[model samples]
Target: MKEEVTQNYLEKVKAQIAKLQSFSIVRIPREENIEADYLSKLAIVKEGIIPPNAPIRYLELPSIFALDVQVQAIDYSNSWTGPIVDYITNGTLPDDNVKARQLKI
Candidate 1:
């Protein structure tokens, strides 16, 4: 039943997208979908804390922990040589760092 509902909803969405002259659809594997899925989960977790009305599930903690650890590992690896390599290859620190600092200001 749930699968049928989901397929119906997706078909509706596809029809709507087809009506839009500039829209395109590209299907990718579930493995390629993980980053987007993780980012969406993180947003839900952040929003849940702010509104304080939703029921928080223990299951969410593992996803949050996995994302946190992945971020920390990237930060650690980047701390060693990311900046130097970026400057050498691109001639400056990445625009992401600049944009982040600007947001804090």
Candidate 2:
């Protein structure tokens, strides 16, 4: 029974690690990991029912896109695109007839 429980725990851990394709696992000793010990003591308090399709949201660092920034600069010009930009940014209709028609299309 004990061996079966250990095998089940190991399988669950393996499945979780498999989801993270590019990750480095660091084994920290209990004596050196004070934060882990402290965090384990904090009990989870559920206030409301979680949705059936609730996503397992995980923290991810924002990706740097130098090419996308450069493309945006090349694609749009403030001089001619101010009205369209205003409409997009503030959800307001452009005063100019030509720009307004273009936006609608």
Candidate 3:
């Protein structure tokens, strides 16, 4: 059912794409979009952004074991794809036997 909805949406999108002379879609990471991110942060901190009677309770935890303030995650220094790409390109394996065996499997 989800796939059918996706296919229908894609067909509509393709029809629109055909009508356009030129268009490009580029995904910007949230961290890279600092200006928009700053605006959003300001809006969230403002009191009465929503009605006081609104049942929604916003819980922003700094850490799982934390107060309302939390720090951003450090960006992936060694991303998940690093090991996989190394294994495929140069047949490199982690020094740990367990991890190398798991990768093979």
Candidate 4:
């Protein structure tokens, strides 16, 4: 399940990357970044010292891309959701316009 969640998040990241006109991802050496040293020290401090003004957010769902595992259960064992799931998750659909339109929903 953890792997599934990670993969789902990765797919979302890839989708966002697809929309970029241009971008670059790089790594900075910790030795050259003093902020990294300070942040590491801060992690050793006691927990829950957050200010009341600091907005505390909680996740009700494991992730925004939570899997709909029961989508295949809609028809009582018949696998009608395969097409829709494929369409939504992978952007894959039939070439026919009508079929693609139906899957878009």
TM-score of each: 0.26, 0.28, 0.30, 0.34
Among all candidates shown, the one with the greatest TM-score? 4
Q: What residue pairs are clashing in model 4?
A: none
Report the C-alpha lDDT of model 2 over 1-105, residue by residue, as the tens digit: 668766766776686689786768799986797655544433242545443443434346322211233234444545677667777887767777887888878
How do these models rank on TM-score, best leading? 4, 3, 2, 1
Better of 1 and 2 by TM-score: 2
Residue-wise C-alpha lDDT for candidate 4, range 1-105, written one tens digit per residue: 889888888888787689799879988887897666556655675685543333445678866546634334244224677667777778888778998888776
| Candidate 3 displacement at residue 104 in angstroms | 70
Indicate whether candidate 2 or candidate 3 has the larger lDDT.
3
RMSD of 2: 16.6
lDDT of 3 by residue, 13-84 (tens): 787699799989998887998665655565677664753333454567312323334579745339887667
The C-alpha stretches of model 1 lying farther than 4 A from their native spots are: 24-51, 55-105
- In lDDT terms, which candidate is top? 4
The residue pairs found clashing in candidate 1 are none
| Comparing 2 and 3 on TM-score, the stronger one | 3
Q: Rate the local accuracy (lDDT) of all candidates.
A: 0.56, 0.60, 0.68, 0.69
Cα lDDT of model 2 overall?
0.60
Listing every candidate in turn, what is its Cα RMSD in Å to the true structure after a full C-alpha superposition? Answer: 17.5, 16.6, 17.9, 12.7
Stretches of model 3 off by over 4 angstroms after superposition: 32-105
